[model samples]
Target chain A: MIEIVNLHKSFGKNQVLRGATLKVEKGESMVVIGGSGSGKSVLIKHIIGFLKPDEGSVMIDSVDIANLSENERYETRKRFGMLFQMAALFDSMKVWENVAFALIRHGKLKDKEAKEIAVEKLRAVGLVGVEDLMPSELSGGMKKRVGLARAIAHSPEILLYDEPTTGLDPIMADAINDLIIEMKKRLSVTSVAITHDMHSAYKIADRIAMLYEGRIVQTGTPDEIRNTDNAIVRQFITGSAVGPIKIEGVTA
Target chain B: MIRLIELIGRFVEILWSTLMSFARELGKILLLLCATMKQLILPPFELKNTFKQIIEVGIKSLPVVVITAVFTGMVLALQSYTGFKRFNAEVLVGTVVALSITRELGPVLTGLIVAGRAGAAMAAELGTMRVTEQIDALETLATNPVKYLIVPRFIAGVIMLPSLTIVADFVGIIGGYFVGVTVLGANSSVYWKRTWDYLEITDIYNGLIKACFFGASIAIISCYKGFYTEGGAEGVGKATTGAVVLSSMTILISDYFLSAWLFK
Candidate 1:
């Protein structure tokens, strides 16, 4: 279980997160949906201990990660697997090397053993016969799948996905959405995904949370979120340009 | 009077911000250095990466360092001939070339060349990694980036600079010998004898010491710039440029202080 309480984060004058609270049960898929720069990424970064909150407690399995030492934080992070928005594969490494990076480094697996697992994971993610290729050679959708393969290579207890379906075609996006669902079902992993893709949210989320104006405006089952009467939620779900939720610095 | 005061205040504000920025960067660099040092002493030293960096910084840079050092020595001999001929001290040309190359030009020129080559490469590579989130990915993998990415490079820099300087010094002396004896009609035996007589172990050691410092500074500055890069492609370009400029400047400036301290 992951619990965040009253998270407050600011960058200079821009308050990205303001007293935001959220929780995810064990073995549940919770998707946080919001527009760009809506603090979804920030929330994930805080939970992962990449960025500390100004005032909050990120409780992972009831242990407050905010107060952990550097070494402790690293140990805690070993339980997590994150797929970045850009599919942040290490360009210097081969695809197999990128997938096996965490396993070799943290898990202390031999190079040969790690590569075997990397190939297996790649196959699991529906990619094959591209282990020796560089990330530069992979297509956008392939890179995302490779990223997913790398994330699951370590078999982390928790999975975090940032903008999973952002830069893919509708077909590729649907494939990824399917993969996320399949992975959750197969691995029984507790997952937190942040994406603006409503289609993806509805497909993968057991519970969906809407982050607006630095706080979680609503969190409910996908069906409830679909039927919610909140004006902000409706405006966002419909992707309307004109609504009570103002696009800052732009006039409606 | 009011306008003048306002102008002065604006100038002070600019000056203050500049100073603060410099101070902040200095602090960050110092902190990074401390962390790197701590990692150096800790267990699990990365030998493979250290060897790779050594080959990159020391071996691959050999051609450029040789070209620069050889040309500098040849030019020094030719110019010294012109100056020494008037004073009837043409025999001392060999000693002059040997001393200058060993004590100053070899280390300084090598520093600048490596700063341009290896330093810029380090910055650009690390900068790309930063923007691409590879550094963050390393952290997620439970790897200390300072340890995994930086310590090996730092080790290579400190160890290889002096070794390269040795090559530069010897090659530079040979360059001077070719010019002094072949082009300038100086006595080959006299030139060789004079070079041997005037060049001391201290001069060579001091120069090597300077090269080590230059190497460390170049690695640190380049790594630091790349580590903190924001924005994107433009930011990486800026970091690469900043790394070369800062490393070269640091080598030149530190060379002066090092010379004074070592030879005073």
Candidate 2:
């Protein structure tokens, strides 16, 4: 459903992505694993039509989204939903309003119907009776759940999750992983999730791609990744400090 | 001698770079203004959000504007009375006060005050939204952040600044009346007559027009700073400060040119 080719991005003197490329099939869960600041977020941002690549194209269903006009890109984005690393809920809005935002604005649904759908989506994410509460009133895990609810509220054809399991306890993270699995099964949507959490990546990804130094170093199933011979992939999956991957801001 | 020449070259280079950066920032702000104008004519006018911002930028600013206008008028009256007493033209205090308040103080003071208050608030709010990724989330949901966020503020600022200036003008005239006739012991009927005699409708409308420009500047500058904010909490602080500073400078600087054109 999505294909990125030879993508290159730079922020001033910092070259974050250089010749990175990847592809994902429809209705498949593609998890991108990378260390912090590995341009994982940048890659997905390209797919979602947020950032334009300097060198290459991001093709979604054969259309180069990088070249679309602002209005056209906005139309293309209707098929997408994203959960930010911080949940990024509208602090000014109620939980239900955040979830029902697209429904009211884009879907053109009335308040009553939008609220009903919001409530149903919240329930699907295992959240009940917290619709009227503000985002500031929720815990970290609850905020993530609420974000998930908001993401899936419009039943988007594709979903993107940025560090969905980070900052949560192991149990809470596991629960989020399970929710990701469940949502993929229920909605049958294409998803691209970026995370450093190997456990969550293994649990939720149908195929895992390891992003290293602005390129996809390896792509394989969980079992294959666990048993890979590539030193970088093996070192990353094993969580070893001593590895070929140089830790940023650290002297070897 | 060689060192002095090198120092001069370095200073010129620094000055040129500063000017270039200022020009770039101005270009960005103008682009934002154009984008906002484009969105303004587009469909999906957010009336609810606009009304909310009107209250935020207009009605809520009433007390401070009124207070400033009243004090400014009173000060103008007292100062004019003292100055005119030398030539025994004390009776003209009302005329001076009325003209100054209607044509200059009313809109300028209100603009400065709103730029400090509403402009800063708008920047802080939008900056926080940008850093927190709520803005990105909005884009992902197929919602135009500029339309949903900035257009309402632009409408509110444009609508409310003039409205607030009107209130300021009225209150300021009343203040001058009290100080000139009651406190300073000028003839009540003559003071009232002189206040209206020299104050033309053109003066008030010109001031209102200036207020419109100030309002647009405040909204556009604040939104631009906020919408592009980076670096998190510290970035928010900087954006808020930059909004107020830039808005205030724009108002004051533009006031001179606007006065030159409008009055001439």
Error of 2 at A108 (Å): 1.2
Candidate 1 per-residue lDDT, tens place, A1-252, comes to 999999999999999999999999999999999988889999999989988889988899999998999889989988989888889899988999999998887778999999999999999999999999999999999999999999888889999999999999999999999999999988999999999999999999999999998999999999999999999999999899878888877886
CA deviation > 4 Å runs, candidate 1: none
Point out the worst 10-residue segment of candidate 2 chain A by lDDT.
A44-53
Residue A41 of model 2, lDDT score: 89
Count clashing residue pairs per candidate: 0, 0
DockQ of each: 0.82, 0.94
Every model: iRMSD: 0.8, 0.6
The candidate maximizing lDDT is 2
Name the best candidate (by DockQ).
2
The CAPRI classification for model 1 reads as high
- Model 1 chain B worst lDDT run, 10 consecutive residues: B134-143
Question: Residue B30's C-alpha lDDT in candidate 1?
Answer: 91
